[model samples]
Target: MLLINCPFCGAREEHEFHYGGQAHITRPADPEQVDDKAWADYLYYRKNTLGLQAERWQHSFGCGQWFNALRCSQTHQFKAVYKMGDDAPEGLQ
Candidate 1:
């Protein structure tokens, strides 16, 4: 029974949330000017680390708000949780 903390609604079961892939991926400001390879990289590439990873999750069963979490991929331990637009808590990056 894994639990995830929602920035808006406190801790909730894992089933209450939706995994939204990697976090902090910013879209190109000038998409039309980006090269084909860069575009492909943006669409397909991700830094799949085995240790601590930053990811996005939606608290679907609670507040339905999106937030970011710094988690350990191998252990599933969540280190920090924060709102989507806020800067990550210190010592996370």
Candidate 2:
């Protein structure tokens, strides 16, 4: 099983954390002025990258805190972990 290291609580089983999809998604500044296509893209489109990817995760069973991680999608190996609101190491956040 995959093991995820929580930024706040250290390493733990994967089940303890919840995958929150791709991270660093910037919402439009003016939502009301956004067209249907833009809004749809914002809601449905995702990077879905195969290599190093930034994702949001919550330590549901531990501190219940949220954070971001850079993990390899192909190998499930994490490269970095940082807490929410913290500046991303690679400027991805």
Candidate 3:
């Protein structure tokens, strides 16, 4: 089983956390101005990179704060964990 470190509650089982998908993706200010293609891209598309992915995770069983994690997709290893609004470290971005 993989262990995920919750920034608010320390480490815990991976099942306790919920994957919130890719982080740092922002929505357009004007919904009407956004084209269908752009909306679809924002809603359905993802980078899906292999190594060193920056993603948003929620500590569902812990302090319940949404945080960012640098995780390896292949081995499910976490490199670093940080709260929202904080810098993503040098390598993660």
Candidate 4:
């Protein structure tokens, strides 16, 4: 299994955390003004990149805090891990 590093709790097994899907997704400014298609796309569309990708994760069994990580989807290797609201590391973005 993947060994994920939690920003609040330090390194832990992947089973101790929960994957929160792709990061940096912004919701529509006005939900009522959004059409059906746009809303649907926002809810389901994801990059599903092959190489390095940024993802949101939660330390469910530990601190219960959310964080972002830059990892390679193919290799399951994490390049960086940071707390929520922090920008991704330079050169990796």
Which one is best on TM-score? 1
Model 4 spans > 4 angstroms off: none
> Which lDDT tens digits does candidate 2 get at residues 1-93?
878888777889998989999887879999999999999989999998888888899998899988989988999998899877665686543
The lDDT for every candidate, in the order shown, is 0.90, 0.86, 0.87, 0.91
**Judged by lDDT relative to the true structure, which candidate is superior, 3 or 4?**
4
- For residue 40, give model 1's deviation from the true position in Å: 0.9
Per-residue alpha-carbon lDDT of candidate 4 for residues 60-87, written as tens digits (9 for 90 to 100) = 9989999999999998999999987888
Clashes of each: 0, 0, 0, 0
Q: What is the lDDT of candidate 3?
A: 0.87
lDDT computed for candidate 2: 0.86
All candidates: TM-score: 0.94, 0.88, 0.86, 0.89
Candidate 3 lDDT, tens digit per residue, 35-88? 999999888999999888889999987778899998889888899999887778
Candidate 3 ranges with C-alpha deviation above 4 Å: none
Tell me how far the alpha carbon of residue 7 in candidate 2 is from the true structure, in angstroms, after superposition.
1.0
Rank list by TM-score: 1, 4, 2, 3
| Winning model by lDDT | 4
RMSD of each candidate? 0.9, 2.0, 1.5, 1.4
lDDT of 3 at 89: 85
Q: Which ten residues in a row have the lowest lDDT in candidate 4?
A: 1-10
